[model samples]
Target: MFTLSEPLASVIARLKAPAQQGQIGRLRRGIEKEGLRVDPAGRIAQTPHPHALGSKLTHPHVTTDYSEALLEYITPVYCKPHDALAFLGDLHRFSYHYLGEELIWPASMPARLNGNASVPIADYGSSNIGTMKHVYRKGLDVRYGRIMQAIAGVHYNVSLPDDLWPLLREIDPQASDTAASSDADYRSSRYFGLIRHFRRNSWLLMYLFGASPAIDRSFLDGKPAPDWLEAHGSDTLLSPYATTLRMSGLGYQNKVQEQLKICFNSLSNYVGTLRHAISTPWPPYQALGVNQGDTWQQLNANILQIENEYYSDIRPKRVTRHNETPSQALEARGVEYIEVRCLDLNPLLPLGVDAAQMYFLDTFLMWCLLSDSPWIPDDECDHLDDNRRLVVERGRDPAMRLNIGGELRSVPERGHEIFTELEAVAELLDILEEGSPHSDAVRGLAPLLDDPSLTPSGRVMARLKETQQSFAEVMLALAREQAEQFRREPMDAAHRALLDELIETSHRQQGEIEAGDEERFGAFLEGYFTRAREPRAARAV
Candidate 1:
């Protein structure tokens, strides 16, 4: 079984393992003195808030994004260059789960805007939560006001190759001198990181849809809107920045297409997806020598000034620039790696995932790649979008239809086809990892596909409605289980500390950003998008 440990010891140990002995000693002693609880509820609950923030009862707008985002990004399973996903192994047998943090914003505020201050959040908020911060279930659109720290999901990732680093900047770097001395900002660096991930790892998904209101409701005991409903559950409350599209009104073909056009307006898209057949970059552009020197820095500064001037959030503000960049990992060839985005925070399993779940995910991904989906046709491009909604709202409904081969077919039947294709994938992984999670994870998908109740999102909605508890309550129960898991399983030093630090910093950042101030809001949108463009330390360094 995979090892799990308390954040205090586990996380630090992992990050510091390669550090000097003195640093390691300092880290260990700090842990001993601080005494990692991993018991957030015990600690967090005790730290009472007069405001009583966070809720399982997500806001209408929040639910709206949840519903729509899922439709755009989720897929049944991603595989190829990402076959490692299938190698997952046995989940902790349904036991006392050690749920991680529940990233949330203050309950009183509208979920639309994030506050500058870190409030007491649960999971991964850009607040502390048990999950990954980058995996926010919500959209990180710059137009959405300031950047809110939350769990990132399928929407905020990319996968590509190492060689794609030099071509990340929207404009050339030869004009800027500081570009040499100062580190490449995260936006440029990580953009390349994303490219490498997509190029090298390849991804697959179970559903194309992301978090949806209807899907969230489906999981509840209460009846929700049927799966057939096609609409953005979010209200028409547009961000002030929505005007960037010059939308006279939200036109279907025009606006959607417009958004798509702008979103893909980057160098990489034309180079990669458009040129999948080529071995090297297309019609190769000359590389800006890394040592272009001081001239490049001056040019970059001028570019930064221009970006700051025109780029504002939904709310306008005086120019306040962010010092955005990635944490360095170049020493080890950068931290560009796969981000597992589709998995929901399983209420049934603690640690937000299981052996079977992980295994299934891995195998499913293998099948996803091996199934050999063609370069998606323009017409079929929306299939991934369709799957997101299906999985979120109607994931468990037997009648749910998913788009496959350009057709909307019921979840079960289509799932059977998908799983059938996956059998080979599972076998491959079984061979590679030798009885790893991939086999079990792939094998388990059919049951989830066939039995709606078995799905994580479905179970959450069910528990909330039938038990008549708030989403908060549902999460609390899960958290309790997860906490127990944390206690029982004993996390490694790195993982545990990562979790704890994420929680603490999440909270701290929540305090800073949740105020939803103009500067904070701008930061959220700009920072997220900016980071999206940059390179990870490995390639650039």
Candidate 2:
């Protein structure tokens, strides 16, 4: 049996006590789900972003990710997970209303792509910032190609309350500090610790929730299918034991990134490493150049066009101010929350995700923070990568083994060990919520562990087998069904009104930005890169 450390056990005990029942209130959470807009025939939409949805640049809630067809919906942070999910549902309802004949593809892997030309990079009006955003996507097209960029997923942003950290510090005397100035740094450091632990165990998430075991053949372009993948139909390729091909090399995998050894040991190391990548030039990107005859191809010929390009399963995030880079925000304000980037869009759900999943994530993340996370050595980090690949590619294999701290253990055995700890955390959360929702969610995952066939990936494969449908056909059918369901449901009046107001305001804001640009585009780009390279404290000085 796995044992919780003394400090974590005591924290769990105190939180579960009756006296502390209502003290925690609720942890703050936010959701960002991305889906590709497809026509009734299920092909990627070639149409521009619908004007009714507001400017993809200025809109706070709605935006385009990499391709214009990829719609990203973001919810404001909420104390209650239900409220956060409700907001996401509302966004979907509003989006469906303006989609006309199009449907939001329910899965993370994209719909059929004719080729690179068929995938349109998102265009964000004429402002410098807008152009910067567009040009960055162009750079991605140049580096990674559009098909890989079109794969979409959900990002779950979560943070515990400020008070909870003080309580945590009290429990750990070594982490305790008397100065207010140091509080933010302490919180940031602790979040990094949480990140370290999350990377080590995130394979469990891929196994349980991963839903993309197969993909449309068009997603592979003209490349030959790997030997392990079998043709599901004339137009689709399926992986027998694979969980999330979206998390696999088929999606967001870059060879250049493999060399980046970004350290999560501390905030400084993490920032320094990413900053170095942004400034460092690479031969492949350099050959592409920043522009091809007057057309901007990318922002720079560096290893990274920006920090957002460095794809990872999780990220230490801080909400950025207008015109600020992500690294700048982290350096100035510290890490406010962490974003879980590995979750596949469960095509089975109308909202792409649900309250039960959110509850499980909350419990799981808290468990990660409470657990003892040792510093991951460079070699162990490589092993961590191996573990993720194994899970995503062959997780359902009963005999699959993973290296945990230099020891080999079966996937089921390791998963059970983690679940045992998660259950205890869930009970503590249930105590905090004055209900059993958290515990219920944890118990819900038990059947999946016992019977691998019950997992989302298993269900996806089973649906394909039973129906004899291609990946696109199955996902498109679900997409059309979900669209109809959303269309039939009336939007809440308050949410409808709020969305309408945001649409009008964002359009006006984008116009103002276009009108107010005084600096030349070239100068603006140069200045932005220069400022991004400077240390935050030095820039302030």
lDDT of 1: 0.30
Q: Give candidate 1's error at residue 203 in angstroms.
A: 13
Let me know the TM-score candidate 1 reaches against the reference structure: 0.43
Evaluate model 2: give its lDDT: 0.88
> Ten-residue segment with the worst summed lDDT in candidate 1?
26-35
Compute each candidate's TM-score over C-alphas: 0.43, 0.97
The 10 consecutive residues of candidate 2 with the worst lDDT sum are 172-181
* Superposed Cα deviation of residue 480, candidate 2 (Å): 1.3
Cα lDDT of model 1 by residue, 1-541, tens digit: 2221232123223333222222211100000000011123322121221112121122110111221211011211222322211111111211112223422211111122113222123232332221112223211122221122222222212232232223222223331643653233333334333332222212123331111122212121233433343322232111110111110111101221222321222233422221222112212111211114221111121112112212110110111124332221222133333334333233343323334644554444333322222244445445554454344434544565666656667766655655665564465444434344555666655676555555444444455457765443444455456545444654345433433344345345555653444443334444555553444333433
For model 1, the stretches where C-alpha displacement exceeds 4 angstroms are: 1-142, 145-258, 262-267, 270-337, 484-541
